[model samples]
Structure formats: C-alpha cells, structure tokens
Target: ELKVEQNPLFLSMQEGKNYTIYCNYSTTSDRLYWYRQDPGKSLESLFVLLSNGAVKQEGRLMASLDTKARLSTLHITAAVHDLSATYFCAAEPSFNNDMRFGAGTRLTVKP
Candidate 1:
C-alpha cells in the first residue's frame, strides 16, 4: 500500500506572493499527478510528472517530481485572488498503479 502526505493543509497568501505545497509518498512510483479544485467543483488536473525530474507549468502554477525520493511539489508564483482553491497530488503506488492521493492543501489568496 502507498501512503501520501501533504504539508500546509491550509494557506492564506497575499496577491503577488509565492508559496509551495509539498507531497511525499511512502513507496515507489513512476507517475505523479497534481490537481486543483475550487469550492463546489471537481478536480482539475494541473500537472503530470511521469519520471524523475519531470515538471509542468501552467500560468502561475508549477509542479515537479523526484521519483528517487518519492516526492512531488507544487509551486505557486505571484499569487492572485482567483487562484484560491485546493490542490492535491496523487501517485501510482508501488508499481501496482493502485493510486493514492495526498490530503490536499487549501490556498486562499487575498488581494
């Protein structure tokens, strides 16, 4: 089984600031994915890290993974009120691809 951990479950940031959310897994996997969700909404895929050092960026959000360490990260740059939402990371566990998800980080960006 795979265990996933995420830090800073809640974040409040001012517009124009920067922050990062981290994800750690207890087991090995080749695939990691990041997602975003707004209140009363469904998950929206933001990134897909398929290998070591894989990274993806869209607008103010960036995501990366280190397969050797079973770690992934989501970086937010130049915060904006519109960016307020919850973020999650999921991993394909132990090569079984069973899939496990992090607890999620809720970010509130203020102007």
Candidate 2:
C-alpha cells in the first residue's frame, strides 16, 4: 500500500513571504505530481516530478522529489494573494500501481 503524508495542514502568509510544504511517502514511487486547487475550482497540475532529484517550477511554485527518501517538497517563493489555494502531492507506488495523495496544505496569502 502507498501512504502519503503532508505537514502544516494550514498556512497563513503575508504577500511576498516564502514557505515550503512537504510530502512523504511510505513506498517507492516512480512518479510524483503537484496540484493546486482554488475555491470551487478543479485541480490544476503544477508540477510533474518523474525521477529522483527531478524538479519542476512554474510561477512562484517549485516542486522536487527525492526517490531514495520517498519525499517531495513544494516551495513557494514570494507568495502573492493570488496564490492562496490548496496544494496536493500525489505519488504512484511501483509495488501496486496505486496512486495516493497527501492531505492538502491549505494556504492563504493575505495582504
């Protein structure tokens, strides 16, 4: 079974601040994906980290994975109010081909 964990279930930040959300998995995973969700909106993919030490970035968000550690991180730089949303990290475990997602990190960027 693949289990995923995330920390800082909630975050409140001021504009221009920086923060990082973490994702840890219990088993070996060959792929990881980061997604963002806004109120009443569907999920939007932000990054697709495919291999060990793989990293992807778009806008103020960056995501990376370390396959050996079964861990991934989403770094937010210079946060803006428009960045407020929920972020989720998902992983597909090689053992079972099942995908699991971490509990979302809800972020609120205030002015």
Candidate 3:
C-alpha cells in the first residue's frame, strides 16, 4: 500500500513571508505534482517535478522532488494574499497510473 503524508496541515503567515510544504511517500514514485485550490474553486496545477532532483518554479512558488528519499517539497517565497489557498501534492508510482494525494495544507496569508 502506498501512502502520502503532508505536514503542517494548516498554516497562517503574514504576507511577504516564506514557507515550505512537504510531501513524503511510502514507496517509490516516478513523479509528483503540486496543486493549489482556492475557496470553492477547482484544483490548479502549480508544478510538476518529474525526475530525481527535479525542480520547477513559477512566480513565488517552487517545487522539488527527491525520488531517492521518496519526498517532495513546495516552497513559497514572499507569499501574498492571493497565494492563500489549499495546496496539495500527488505522487504517481512507476507501477500504475494510480496517484495518491496527501492531506492538503490550507494556507492563509495575512497582510
């Protein structure tokens, strides 16, 4: 059985601060995706880390994957109110098409 875990499920920070969200999986995964969901909105793909040590960044968000450790991280730099949303990480194993999502981390950026 494959399992995913995310820490600091709820985060509250002031604008312009920096934070990181972590995703750890129990087994080997080929890739990982980071997503963001606003209130009452659909999930938006933020970043896709494809290979070991793969890193992707867009705007204030950056994502990295360490396949050997079975871990991934999403880093937020100089966060803004618009970035306040629920963030999720999904891992896709090499075996099948199945993807497992970690418990989302709900973030709130205050002014």
Candidate 4:
C-alpha cells in the first residue's frame, strides 16, 4: 500500500473558523511537505518538514512533522473565502527522492 494517508477527503468551513488536517504514513520517511491548490490552479508550497519536531507556518497555515511517529499536521487558522482550496501532504522515503501525496483535503471556505 501507499505510505501516506489523510483524513476528511472534503471539508467545508465558514469564514473565521479553524480546522486541522492530519497526515499519517505507514513507513519511515525523511521528509514531509504540505501544498495548497486552488480550483484549476497549480500547487502553492506550504511547508517542508525535514525532521522530527520540524514546524513551519505562513499566513493562516501551520504545518508540523513528527518523524518518530510518521505523522504530520496542517492546521488552518481563521478560514476565509480565499482559502478555499485543496490541501495535500506528501511524504518522501529516506532512501528515495520520489514523494507520494495524500488523496487531498478539498476545503471550501464560505463567504
């Protein structure tokens, strides 16, 4: 089976609300990354977690990696209409550079 999994394939949030997305991997990996994509748009880089306890944030998003637990988290703070997009978390195995992405969390931020 693929190494990574994410919950809630779809999410809808009202403006000013908050939510957290979870990512779990089946095996050890060297890196974890998060990305966002708007409708019909390319991905926008969110965070890159390279080691255990690695955390990064930009704007309304925050991401963290726990290599020991083979998990990652993407927390969204204060949703907005503009935040409507699909969020994906990917994991790269320690032995290889190829990364695998989650099915994706399709978020809709209502006005």
Candidate 5:
C-alpha cells in the first residue's frame, strides 16, 4: 500500500484566512517532507523532518511530523494570493528508497 495520504485535494481559501491540511501514512517511514509547487514550476522544498515531533515553519506555512502516528500536518496561518499553490507531503518508507507523495492539496487564495 501507499505510505502517504492527504485530505482536501482542493482548498479554496480566502485572503487572511487560516486552515490546516492533514497527511496520513500507512506505515513507519524514514522521513517526511512538505513541498510547494507553483503553476508549471518545480517543487519548492518546504520542510524535511527525519524524526518524530519535528516541526518547522516558514512564512505563512508550518509543518509537523509524528513518526509514531505516521501523520503530518501543514497549517496555513493567513492565506494570500501569493500563497496559492499546490502543497504535497511525501514519505520515504523505512525499507525502501522510494518516496510516496500525496495527491496534493491545491490551495486557491482568493481576494
């Protein structure tokens, strides 16, 4: 089975609003990561967490990982048009080199 899953494949958020996305995995993993992508652009690495209780944030986004629970969270403090993009969470399995990505949360920040 795939290791990673994310909810709300599409998120329509208003400016100055706050929201959170959830990522759940099926098994233990070596690493978890969050990435953002703009239209027609490559992914922009957001966070890489290797252990449980690891949390990191930049700008309006915050990410956390809990290895024991096999879950991750991405919180958006205040949405903006500039923050409109696709967010993905990935996991590297403990026994394999492959990384599995979530379907992705597409955030649309409206004015």
Candidate 6:
C-alpha cells in the first residue's frame, strides 16, 4: 500500500513571498502529479513528474520529484493573490498500479 503525507496543511503568505509544499510517500513510485483546486472548483492539473529528479514549472509554481526518496516538492516563487488554492500531490507506485494522494495543502496569498 502507498501512503502520502503533506505538512503544514494551511499556509497564508503575502504577495511576493515564496514557499514550498512537501509530499512524502511510503513505497516506490515512478510517476507523480501535482494538482490545484480552487474553492468550489474542480481540480486542475499542474505538473507530471515522470522520473527521478524531474522538475516542471508553470507560472510561479515549480514541482520536482525524487523517486529514490519517495518525495516531491512544489515551490512557489513570488506568490500572488491569484495563486491562492489547494494543492495536491499524487504518486503512482509501479507495483500496484494504484495512485495515492496527500491530504493537500491550502494556500492563501494575501496582498
């Protein structure tokens, strides 16, 4: 079974500040994905990290995966109010073909 843990469930940041959200998984995974969800909105795909040390960035967000450590990170640079949302990280293990997701991190960017 695969399990995921995300820390600091809630974050409040000022605009122009930076932060990083972490996702840790138990078990080996080769594929990982990041997603964003706004209040009352469906999830939006952010990034797909396919290999160890893989990194992807879009806008002010960057996601990276470390397969060997069973961990992934999402870094937000120069956060903006428009970036406020809930973020989730999911990992798919090679053995079971199943994906497990972290509890999610809710971020609020203030002006």
Candidate 4 segments exceeding 4 Å error: none
- Root-mean-square deviation of each candidate, in angstroms? 0.9, 1.0, 0.7, 1.1, 1.0, 0.8
Residue-level lDDT tens digits of model 4 in 16-104: 99999999998888889898998899988888899899989898988998888888999989988888889999998878888999999
C-alpha lDDT of all candidate models, in order: 0.90, 0.91, 0.92, 0.89, 0.92, 0.92
Cα lDDT of model 1 by residue, 5-51, tens digit: 99989999999999999999988886898989999999998888888
What residue pairs clash in candidate 6, if any at all?
none
TM-score of 2: 0.95
User: What lDDT does candidate 2 reach at residue 86?
Assistant: 96
lDDT per residue as tens, model 2, 43-91: 9988889899998888898898999998899999999999999999999
Residue 104, candidate 4: C-alpha displacement in angstroms = 0.4
**After superposition, which runs of candidate 3 have C-alpha atoms over 4 Å from their true positions?**
none
What does the lDDT come to for candidate 4? Answer: 0.89
**lDDT for model 1:** 0.90
- Clashing pairs for predicted structure model 1, backbone only: none
What does the lDDT read for residue 81 in candidate 6? 96
The residue ranges of model 2 lying beyond 4 angstroms of the native Cα positions read none
Weakest 10 consecutive residues of candidate 5 by summed lDDT: 1-10
Residue-level lDDT of model 5, residues 1-111, one tens digit each, is 556889989999899999999999998898998999999999999999898999999999999988888899999998889999999999988889789999999999999
